[model samples]
Target: MKLFRPATLVTLFTLAVSPARAWDYEGHRAVNQLALAALPTNFPAFVKTAEARERIAFLAGEPDRWRNITDDQALPHVNGPDHYLDLEQLEEFGLTPETVPALRYDFVAKLALARAQHPEKFTAIDPAKNKDHTRELVGFAPWAITEYCGKLRSEFSYLKAFQHYGGTADEIANAQQNILYTMGVMGHYVGDGSQPLHATKHHHGWVGENPHGYATNSSFHGWIDGGFFKKIGGVKVDAIVGKIRPAKIVGDPLKPEDLFRQMMAYFGDTEKLVAPLYQLEKEHKLTPENEHADEGKAFLETQLARGGQMLGDLWFSAWEQATEDRYLVTELKKRPAASAETK
Candidate 1:
C-alpha cells in the first residue's frame, strides 16, 4: 500500500531512463490502467477505498518512471553485449518455484525476487528493497516471456489460493500472507507480453557479434521489441484511446491456471518468434541517428507506444475471455430503480 513518493520519482528520473526500459514500460502503464478500470465496477465499493485509489494510481502511473532505467550498458543487444547468460538465464528463471535454495546468489531468487535475487532480475525488487518504491513497481517482463511465465505461474497461484486459504478482499489488502501476490503475477506477465521481444525469440540479437558488432547502430535490445514501430509510423495515443477495454471486461474474478493458459499463446509464439526474429533482426533496426538523437528517440517512442497499446489489448483480452461470454461489463447497462423511474 506504499505509494510512490516524489523523491523516488526524482531519483528514477535522474537515473533509470533507457531505451529498453521505455519499450517495456509503456506496456506496464497500459496494462495497469486496464486493471484500474476494473475497480469502479468489479469492486464498486472500491471507489471510496483509499487503498483502492492508491492501487489504481500505483498501477496506472507505475511504468512512466521506467524510462529512467534504460542505459547504454543494460543487457540485450541494444544496450550492450549479450555478455551474461541471457537466454539460459530465462530457463533458469523458470525454476523459481522449486525451492528457495541458496542465499543471495541463486537464480530461483531471481525468479521470485528479481533484483534481490539478481545481484537485478525483476528491475524493481532491488530498488524497492532499497526503499525506492517508485522503481519498486514491477517493470512487467523485463526478461523473455518463457522465463517470466514460469515465475508468473508461481506468483498467480494466489488467484486461486484465496479459495484454499482465506481469500477475500480484505485479505487481498492487509491480510497476513500473500495478499497482493497474484497481482504481482499479473504485473510480470503483463510486462512480458508487453515486450514484443519477450514474446519473440529474436530476444537479444541476431547471428552473433559480427553482424551488428555491438555497435550503437544495431543493438538487439531495442531491435526486437522496439524497432518495428520505429520503422512504421508512430501510433497516435489519442486515436487509439477508443480501443481500450474496461477492466471488468478485461478480467473476470481470478483463476490461476486458466489465466496462465490463456496467455500461453503469447509466450509460446514469442519463443517461436525468437529464432526467426533474431535471424532477421538485422532488418529491424531503423536508421540510427548519430546526427539526430531525436530521430532515434522518435522511432523508439512510436514503438514503445505501440507496445503499450498491445499490452492494453492483451490485458483486456484476458479479462474479456474471463467473462466467459457472459455480459461484458463495459457493454452492460444500468436501469433506474422503479421509484426513481416513476419520479
Candidate 2:
C-alpha cells in the first residue's frame, strides 16, 4: 500500500500489524448492513432492494481498498485523512467543539496559525510524527460526510427530475449509481467516527503518562475492530439499532454551515466514549470470554448503531431538502407562459 508520508511508513513498520484502516473490512461491512436496515421509511425504494444492499455492503470497504491501488497510488492518501479526528489535538489551537471550523482545510489553516503563535504549546509538524497523529492533527471525517450528504441530495434531486422530464433509461441508471456510491463513501467515514479510538489521542495504543497503565500494545485497534467481533459472532445489530434514539434533523440540510452544527453534535457524542474504551482495556475486558467484556461489547455496539442511525437520518434529510427544491425549479422552468388573449 502507498504511504501518505515517510512518517506513516515508519509507524506501520514498527507496529508489524495494525493496518491504517479503521474497523477491519468485516467490521465495515457489518456496520453497512445495519445502516441499510435502519434507513428511514422514506428512503429510496432502490436502496431498500436486496441487490442494492448487497452492493452497498460490498462498497463500504472501498476507502480502505483504495489505499492499495496500483494504477493511481496517490488517490489513496488523498482521502486517508477523512477517517478520524483527534479532538484533543485541536486544543492547542483553542478550537473547542463550539469553535471548530466547518471545512477540513480551514481546520488545518487554523492549526497552522495557532502553531505560529503558540510555539511553546505545540511542536511544529515534522517527519517524525506518526501517520495517525498526522491525520488527526486536523482530520476531516466530519466535513467529508457532510459534503457527501450534499452530493447525495443533489443526486436524489436529479433522479426525481429524470422522472418528471422523461429522462432516458441511461440517465436514470447513472443517477442511481451515483447515489449508491456516495452513500457507501459517506457511510465509511461516519462508521469510522463511531469508533471511540478514532477520535482520541490514544488511537492505536495508549500513550503518555498513564497512571492506570493501559495496554501499550500496537494491536489494540485491530483487536477492537475485528478480533473481538470475530470471537463473539459480531454485534447484535438488531437489538442495538432498535435502541438507538431516532435521528432528529435540527437545521437546514443544504447549508454546510448549518449542517456543521449537527455534525459536531454527533462527533461530540462519539468523543465522549473514548475514555470508556480505554477503561475497558485497562480492566482487561476486551475479550469474548471475559466476564467484564460485556461492557466493552455494549460500548462498541452502541457506537456502531449510532453510526447507522445518523447515516440514515442524513440520507433521509438530504432527499427531503434537495428533492423539494429540484421539483420547484423544474416546475417553474416547464410552466407555459400566459396567452395574450387571457391578458
Candidate 3:
C-alpha cells in the first residue's frame, strides 16, 4: 500500500488550498452518452428513448456545474471531494487499497478517529480552510458511486412495482426518467475514476521529487483532459457511443455487499492506471495534442471506453436485480392486467 510520501506535504498542502473539480463537463457527457447507448433492450423503456438519452447525457455534467458555486458555499457538503479519491490517503485511515469501509460516513468516522489518534498522519481538517478542500484528503468519489448505485437500484425496484401494477404510461415514464437521471449522475463519478489523475495525489502538477521527470506542468491536467477531447474530434459522442460494451460482472452487484466490493475494485483498477499515466508523459507519448497522438490517444480511448462499459453494466445489473424482488412478483400477481387497467 503506497502512502503519500512526507516529501509531498507542501505539494499536498498547496493542492488543499482550493476546490478543484474533475474531468470537464464535456468528458462527463461523452462517457454517459456512450453508456446510455450501450444499455440493453431490457433496460427501462424511457432510458432507451432518444430524448431521455439526450437528457441523461446532458445531466452527466451536472455535478461539475455545481462547482461553479463558490468554495465556501460548497464546502460543508464536501462537493470538491465528490469528484475524486487520492488512494494513498486511505493509509491515514488504516485502510489499504484492498480494504475499505462500506459506507461513506463510516469511512469519514474512521478517518476522524485515526486523525485523533495520530495527528501527524494528516493536515488538520480545519473548518476555516475550505471543508471541501480538507475533506478531499480522503475523497468521497468511491462512496459516491456506491451510494448512487443504491439509489438507482431503489428507483429500478419502484419502476418494477409500477410495471407490475400495470401503471399508466406517464407513471412508468416518470420512474424511468428518475432511473436515467440517477444513472447520469452515477456515470460522472465513474468517468472521474477513469481519468487516472483523479485517483492520486499527483493529480495536477507532479507531487514530490522529480526523479522520473514526469510532467510538472500545472496546465497539464486541463490541457490533457476534456480540453484535448474537445479539441480532437476522436472522442466525440458519436465516435465513442458506438464502441461501448457492458462489463461482465462476476456476481450480482445490486447486493449491498457486492456493490461495495465492486465499487472498491473499480476504484482500485483506476488507481493502478495513475502510474502509467505519468509514464506516458515520461515517455513523451502524452501531450496537449494527444488526441491525435498515437499511444496517448489509444490510452484515452481505452479509459473512456472502460468508463462507458462499466456504467452500462451497473445500469443493467440494477435492472436485473430489481426484477428479482419478491415485491415485483407479488404486485404483478395480486392484480390481473384487466382489473389493473380499469383503474
Could you tell me the lDDT of residue 167 within candidate 1? 46
Candidate 1 vs candidate 3: the lDDT winner is: 3
Residue range with the least summed lDDT across 10 consecutive positions in model 3:
1-10
Q: Put the candidates in TM-score order, highest first.
A: 3, 2, 1
Q: Where does model 1 exceed 4 Å of error?
A: 1-22, 37-40, 43-185, 208-218, 223-239, 246-260, 271-343
lDDT of every model, 2 decimals: 0.36, 0.71, 0.71
For every model shown, what is its TM-score relative to the native structure?
A: 0.38, 0.83, 0.84
**lDDT accuracy of residue 283 in candidate 2:** 83
TM-score, cand. 3 vs. native: 0.84
- 1 or 2: which has the higher lDDT? 2
* Tens-digit lDDT string for candidate 1 (1-343): 1112232112322222221322333334444444444333543242335564345335443333332354422322221111111222344344321232212224334545654555444333354233333232212232322233333333334333433343456544432223233333335344444344554223333322345432222245544333444444543344444444443232123543333343444344344544443333334334443344344444334333433444444333432343222222222222234336788
Please estimate how well model 3 matches the true structure, expressed as its whole-model Cα lDDT. 0.71
Candidate 2 ranges with C-alpha deviation above 4 Å = 1-20, 70-73, 128-136, 236-241, 244-250, 254-256, 324-343
Report clashes for each candidate as comma-separated counts. 20, 0, 0
